[model samples]
Target chain A: AQTVTQSQPEMSVQEAETVTLSCTYDTSENNYYLFWYKQPPSRQMILVIRQEAYKQQNATENRFSVNFQKAAKSFSLKISDSQLGDTAMYFCAFMRRLNSGGSNYKLTFGKGTLLTVNP
Target chain B: DAGVTQSPTHLIKTRGQQVTLRCSPISGHKSVSWYQQVLGQGPQFIFQYYEKEERGRGNFPDRFSARQFPNYSSELNVNALLLGDSALYLCASSMRTGGYTFGSGTRLTVV
Candidate 1:
């Protein structure tokens, strides 16, 4: 079983500043994918960024980026130019491609970290 | 295209009563997943259905059951609801090739 761990329960960042949220996972399989999701008070999970285990380069979308260290089993998300709208609960997730074709892939998620962007 | 859609934005039911939640996947999606998010906690997977068949189930008890229809719509039913079951129930839709797109979620309050 794969388990994602987010050590920080809460994080605070000033407006326009940068913040990094840490995430680590345990998985025996070498081929997998990592994702960062954001859920605001609305309770909707939104994909922030994704990293393919085979890719050496990190993934970035707008202000959101990921620092993926496959050897260390670490995948951290960095939010540059943080804004108030970015304040939300962030979760790290893991997904392993199944060997069997035509199968639905499952995701394992971390507890989450509450991020507050202070003005 | 429209994203994942879930009905009964909020529901309130007493303990021991049954509650049903509905979800409709995105236009082209074939997989739908259910998750529970308690206050101050992360969303936990409850069930996953693809092509109208059960694929994955979580650690939740059998009291929590869900089924997907041929149209890629799904429903989650909880029997003998407990106060612990009060939380936001989210439905996400995705394809085998990508990540899930989630709905706003239905808030279930078991009083």
Candidate 2:
């Protein structure tokens, strides 16, 4: 079983500043996918960013980027120019690559980090 | 376009009772998955259905069961509910091997 760990329980960043949330996971599979999800007060899970283990280049989406270190089993999300709307509970999730004839899409998530972007 | 839709936004039930939650997947999406999000914790996978068939199930007990309809809509039923079952139930839909679009979730409260 794979387990994701988010060491920081809560994080706060001032508006227009940058903040990074750390996440690590335990998985023996070399081929996998990692994702960061944001859950707002409305309780809707939104996809923030994703990274493929086979790709060394980090994934970037607008103001969100991930530092994926496969060897270290660490995948971190960096939020730049943060806004108040960015405040939410951030979760790190892991999913193994789809095997032949397999439709496994289950995501194992971390405990989540409550992030507040103060203005 | 409307995202995933979950019905009965919120419900309250007592122990030993039964409850059913409903979800409708986005158009053209063939896979629907269910998750339970306890307060202060991330969502946990409960079940996954694709093409009206059960594809995978999580560690939840037999008390938790779900089925998908021909139109890709899904229903999750809990028989003999417990207080610990109180949580936000989320529904996600996706094309095969694609990213998921999640619904706002139905809040289930068991007293």
Candidate 3:
């Protein structure tokens, strides 16, 4: 079983500044996937970024990026030029790499970190 | 093009009562998964159905059951509801593994 952990319960960042949300996981599987999801006040969860455990290069999507340290099991998300829209509850998730033709795509998520991007 | 759709945005039930939550997967998606999210906590996996078959189940009790229809639409049924069951129930759909689109979720309050 894989477990994700977010040490910061709440984080605050000013608009146009940068902020990083920390995450770590414990997994025995060598190949897997990590994801960061944001749930705003509307209660809709939106995918922010993803990182593959086997890949050394971190994933970057627009203003969202990740620092994935496979050895340390750390996958932190960084938001550059943070905007008010980025204020939300951020959750870090993990999924094991099942064999091809398997459909067990369940995700294990962390408690979450509430991020407040102040204007 | 419609993402995952869950009906009954909010529901209230009494203890020992039963409730059913519905979900319509995105067109062309054959796999659907259910999750339970409590306040101040992350979502917990409940069940996963693919092609109208049960593919996986999480640590939830047997009182929590679910099924997928031929159209890939799914229904989650919870019996003997307790106050602890009050939470947001989320449904996610995907064509395959690694990618998932989630619904806004149905808030279930058990009194």
Q: Which digits, one per residue and each the tens of the lDDT, describe model 2 over residues A2-114?
A: 99999999999999999999999999998788999999999999999989888999999999999999999999999999999999999999986433476657888999999
Model 3, runs deviating above 4 Å = A97-100
Model 3's CAPRI class?
A: medium
lDDT of 3 by residue, B26-68 (tens): 9999999999999999999999898888888899999999999
- Interface RMSD (Å) of model 1? 1.8
The number of clashing residue pairs in each candidate reads 0, 0, 0
> For candidate 2 chain B, which ten residues in a row score worst on lDDT?
B93-102
Cα-lDDT of candidate 3: 0.92
In model 1, residue pairs whose N, Cα or C atoms come closer than 3 Å (at least 3 residues apart or on different chains), thus clashing, are: none
Native-referenced DockQ of model 3: 0.69
Tens-digit lDDT track of model 1 for A26-104: 9999878899999988888999998888899999899999999998999999999999999999999998754367757
Ten-residue stretch with the least lDDT total in model 3 chain B = B92-101
User: In candidate 2, residue A8 scores what lDDT?
Assistant: 100
Best by lDDT: 2
lDDT of 2 by residue, B1-111 (tens): 889999889999999999999999999998999999999999999998988988888999999999999899999999999999999999999886646889999999999
Better of 2 and 3 by lDDT: 2
